[model samples]
Target: MTLHIYNTLTREKEVFKPINPENVGMYVCGPTVYDFAHIGNARPVIVFDVLYRLLKTLYPKVTYVRNITDVDDKINAKARETGEDIRTITERTAAMFHQDMAALNAGNPDIEPRATEHIAEMIDMIERLIENGNAYEADGHVLFNVPSMPNYGALSRRNMDDMIAGARVEVASYKKDPADFVLWKPSDEDTPGWDSPWGRGRPGWHIECSAMSRKYLGDTFDIHGGGHDLVFPHHENEIAQSCCANKTDKYATYWMHNGHLMVEGEKMSKSLGNFFTVHELLEEVPGEALRFYMLSAQYRSPFDFTKEGVREAKATLDRFYTALRQHADIEADDVAAPDHFVAALKDDLNTPLAISILHELLSAFNKAPSPQTKGHLLACADILGILQQDVEGWFTQNTAADATEVDADQIMGMIEERKNAKANKDFATADKIRDDLDAMGIVLEDGPGGTTWKLK
Candidate 1:
C-alpha cells in the first residue's frame, strides 16, 4: 500500500504525494530552547522519527529539517532570572535539548537552523510582505494585516471571532485590526536584535519558522508537522506569512500533527507534580522503553503516560530480547519488513497496530528459531526504533530505583553457587538459593545455556 497521512489542512487521510519523489522534504517545529523538553514535548519527536524512517525506505532521499529558536521572549526571561548572557543561556539549553533527544534515539535532522543565524532571511521575508501590502510597519513594529488575507483562517477553519478569542490577540493601538499578528517586534539593547528595514528588531515567534522553513525546504514542501496545539496560532500565522511573501497559495502540501499527551490522568504540569523532562525520565527508565511505550499508542490518539505503563513497556522489550538471546548463534538475514507491518505504518502511522504485529513476529520467531524468522523480527523492530540494543546487555543493564540496589557481580556469584548445587544433585540447596534471589526482586531463568538473572 502507498503512504497515506492525515492532513490537518484537509481534515482527511489522503495519499502522500511528494512534489518531487526523488527528494522528499519535511519540516517539523522544534523546541524553543529555553528549558528542558517535557514528556509532552517528546510526542512529536518520536512520532515523526518513525515517519522519517519510513520515508527513507520509500524515497531516494529525504531531507528533514527541525529548527531551534534561540532568540525568544522565554529565553530572554530565563536570562534575566539567572542574570546570565542571552547567548550563554540559549547555547546551554540547545545543547541539553540535543543530548536529551539523542538518548531517545532520535536522529538529527539534515538541517538544523537556529533563529539567530537566520535573521537576514527573516528580514527579507518581512520586507516582501510589506511590499505585497500584507503587512505594515506601525509603532516601530511590523504586524501582519489579517484583514488583507481573505481566507485567513483556512487551515484552522475558524471564523474571525473564534480566531481572535482563541489566539487572545493583543488589542494594541498600533495593530490595524484586533486579529493582526506580529511579524517583527522592536527589541531593546538588552534583548537580541538585528538591523532590519523597520528598525533594530527581532523576528516574531511565527515569522522565525516561516523564514527558516522556506529557506531550507522550498515555498511548498511535502510535510509540515508539530504538536496539535500549534494548529491555531503558531502554524496559522506561518501559513499567512509564507504564502503572502512567497506569492504562493500553499505553504506545505501536507500538514500532520500528533495528539496531546497527558501524565497519568491529568494534564502534565509542574504544579501537579506529574511533569517530567525526558532527561530526568532517562535516569529511571531505559530510553528504548520510553520510546516503545510512546509508540504503543497510535500517534493521533491522546496518550496518558503512567509509571506502571512504562514498566510494562520495559518488560515487553525484555521478552523480545530474551528470544533473540536464546538464538544468539543464528545470523539474521538482511531483509525488508513484512508487508503488513509496513502497511500499518503507511496508514497514517498506525504505530499501535504495527507494534501488535511485532508481538506476532516475536511469537513466530520463538516457535521456529531460524535466520529468516529472526531477520523478519529484527526488520520490523527497526522501523519502530526498538529492539536494537545488545541482547545480553539488555538483560544485565540496571534501571528503575530498585534495579540499582543490586550489583551484577553479586547476582552472577549467586547464580554460580546455585549451578554448583544443582550439579551436585542437591536440589534443596538450589531451591533455597532461587528463593533468596526471588526475595531480592530478582528473577532467575534456567535454560540450556545456563541460569541467567535479571531484575524483576
Candidate 2:
C-alpha cells in the first residue's frame, strides 16, 4: 500500500515519498522538562509514536529522533522556585517523562538528543546563519533575521502585516524587526551559560531543534513532526535557521503535526480547574485506556477529553480482552496484520478508521476461535500498541484502591477451591464460593480455558 500524509506545509493530503527510501528519518520535538507532562503534551507523543511504529514496519531502516529541551528558562525557574539544583530538576523531570511515556507504551526514539549536549552544534549553526546574512548578533543576544527569508511565513501563510498585527510575541528594544526571533540570549550568572563569541549565553529554543535535527538526521530529513501549536515561530524559525545555514530550500521533506487537545469541550487550564497530568490520569485509568482514548480521534482533529470517554475506552478494551480470554488455549498467530488495517494507517494515519478495522477483526476472532484469526487480531493490536499485556493479567489487574477489598490472589484461591469442590462432586460448596465472589464485585466467566474474573 502507498503511504500518504497530510503535510501541514502544503495544506493538503499528499502521497508520502521519502527523500531516501533506504534510510527514512523522522524528527519529533520532545518535551521541555520543567514539570510533569500534562494530557495535552501526550497527544503528539502518542500520535507520532504510532507513526514511528508504522514506519518501522514498512521501512528497512528508520531513524526516529526526539530532542529533550533540558536547558530552558522554565527549567531554571523551576529550580529557583523549588530550591533545588538545576541539574536535579531537569534530571528528575526527564526521568519522569520517560516513565510516563513508557507507561503509555511509547518506544524510545532511535536518537534521544538533549539540548545541553548539542550546544556546540547550536553555536556552529548560529555562526553559519550570521555568515549567510540570515541572522544578526546584538546586545549579547543573537536573533534570526526574519525578513532575510522571503518565504518566512510560507509554512503558516501569514503576511508580515498580519503577523505584526496578530502576534503577541515580545519585541525587544534591540530587535531590528518585531518578527525576528531569538537564536541565543544572555544567561545570568545564576543561570546555566555556555561561553560563546556573543559572551556567556544559552541557545534559544528554536536554534536547539535546528542544530539537533541537523546533527542526527543530516541537514535535511524525511519527516518532522510535533504538536500543531509549534507551527508558528518555533517550527517557522527552525526552518529559517536550518535552511539558511545549510544552503537548502527544504530542511524536512514532510511536516506532520497532531491537533490540539481539550477537556470537556473547553481548553484545559490550571486556573480553570480542568488541568490534568498524564500521571494523574494513569492513576484512574490504565495507560492502555488513555492511549486508546487518544487514538479514537484522527491526529489532526481537536479531541475533547472526558471522563466518560476514558471509561468507555476501558470498557472497549475489556471486550477485546474478553475475546482473547475465550481463546486463551490457542496461541496468537505470529504473523502480519490484515491488509485493511495497514491500509487505514497508511492513509494519513487514520487511527479512528484503523480502530474500526480492529473491531472488525475482533468480531472475526469471536466468530472463529482459530489461530489465524487470533494472530491477525493480535498483530493488528501490536501496530496500535494496545493489548500487549497478557489476557489473564488484564482481568487480574486491580486498580481500585480499597484495602478492605479482596485481591486477585484471594479471588483466584476461591476459584481453585471451587474447582476442587466440583471435582469431588460437592456441587453445593462450589456454587456457594461462586456466589460469594459475585457479592464481592467479581464477575466470573467460565470458558474453554478456565474460570476468569473481572471486576464489575
Note each model's CA RMSD in angstroms.
1.8, 1.9
What's the lDDT for residue 439 in model 1?
90
TM-score to true structure, per model? 0.95, 0.95
- Lowest-lDDT window of 10 residues in candidate 1? 396-405
Q: Tens digits of per-residue lDDT for model 2 on 1-456? A: 799999999999999998889889999999999999999999999999999999888989999999999999988888889899988888998999999999898899999999999999999999999999999999999998899998888888888877666556676899999988889999988989999999999999999999999999999999999998998868888898999999998999899999989999899999889999998888677888999999999999999999999999999999999888777788877889889999999999999999999999899889878898889988889999999887877776666555245577799899999999999999999999999998888888887668879876
List residue ranges in candidate 2 displaced over 4 A: 165-167, 401-406, 420-441
Off by more than 4 A, model 1 = 401-407, 425-441
Q: lDDT for model 1, on a 0 to 1 scale?
A: 0.91
Over 1-456, each residue of candidate 1 has an lDDT whose tens digit, in order, gives 999999999999999999999999999999999889899988899999999999998999999999999988998999999999988888898899999888787888999999999999999999999999999999999999998988789999999999999999988998889999998999899888888888898889999999999998989999999999999999999999999999998999999998899999999989999999998899788889999999999888899999999999988998899999889989999999999999999999999999999999898889988898899999988888888788877876666653547777888898899999999999999999999999988889889988888766
